[model samples]
Target: MHETLEIRLTVNERSEAVRIEPRETLADVLRERLSLTGTKVSCDAQVCGACTVLVDDLAMSGCTFLAADADGRSVRTVEGLARDGRLSPVQQAFIDHAAFQCGFCTPGMLMAATAILEEHPRPSRDQVVHGLEGNLCRCTGYEPIIEAVLAAADAGTVDEGVAGW
Candidate 1:
């Protein structure tokens, strides 16, 4: 029998009811089902933060999170970070600092940074590095990314509504 699982999920502050396969990953559901393509999938094994998404308030690897596990929970992808077409401060800082290139890692980087800033608010350089340890960016060097994060923290310019920080 073809089983259709009904799952209710919150994305970008909007609730959705979806049917997914038992084995489908959260990333799959986000991208294919919900069309939230901002969440990328690199290494599906959870080592790479490329598929990172906020599950509740914790950063999680969406590739490993089952769609069923995410049911009725809030999931935030990079797409959800912007409000009314305005980018969040961290996101704007990223753009202002030119922290990304090639862009494969941007989504995960943003998610990781969001989690970092939320936890630390004003994290040390090492803490920033440690927070983003799992995320890998092959295009831009680390300096720009670090600078961007520091700038966002220093400015205290984060849109509280966007990140809830």
Candidate 2:
């Protein structure tokens, strides 16, 4: 039998404990164990940002991140982007701007954008581009995504409450 380790972590502002194999990736744990499928797993090499999730308020590639590494830390997936049924500013911006095409990369883009907004409450266009450079999207040519980030910043939606998760 494969050895398993108990992992305790905060997910979407909720405390959770689960047993996971040492080699399991964060994406597998979140999707299989926790049932948070918002963080997609693709390009297992971390080249595609589909598995992006926020770890301690920083954007991380869930596909390549070990579940054990996330123990005792906070993780926020796409499912956590809403509060009390209200969409987060970043999420709203994506919808308002229609930032996604096929939508396969939306989750990662949202997580990365949220991190960017938290780090730079009022980021410039160039800054927004630079912040999301790690995340790739084959749809919308990125113009709408960039616009959405700018719009979210302009709306003053970046707040400490959103960053806490």
Which structure among the candidates has the greatest lDDT? 2
29-90 in candidate 1: lDDT tens per residue?
Answer: 99998888999999999987999999896899999999999899998899988777877778
TM-score computed on alpha carbons, candidate 1 = 0.93
Candidate 2 Cα misplacement greater than 4 A, ranges: 157-165
- Kindly provide the TM-score of model 2 when superposed on the true structure, using C-alpha atoms: 0.94
Best by TM-score: 2
Model 2 per-residue lDDT tens digits across residues 71-94: 999999999888888788888889
Please list the C-alpha lDDT of all candidates, in the order they appear: 0.88, 0.89
What TM-score, over all chains together, does every model reach?
Answer: 0.93, 0.94
Distance from true location, Cα of 51 in model 2, Å: 0.6
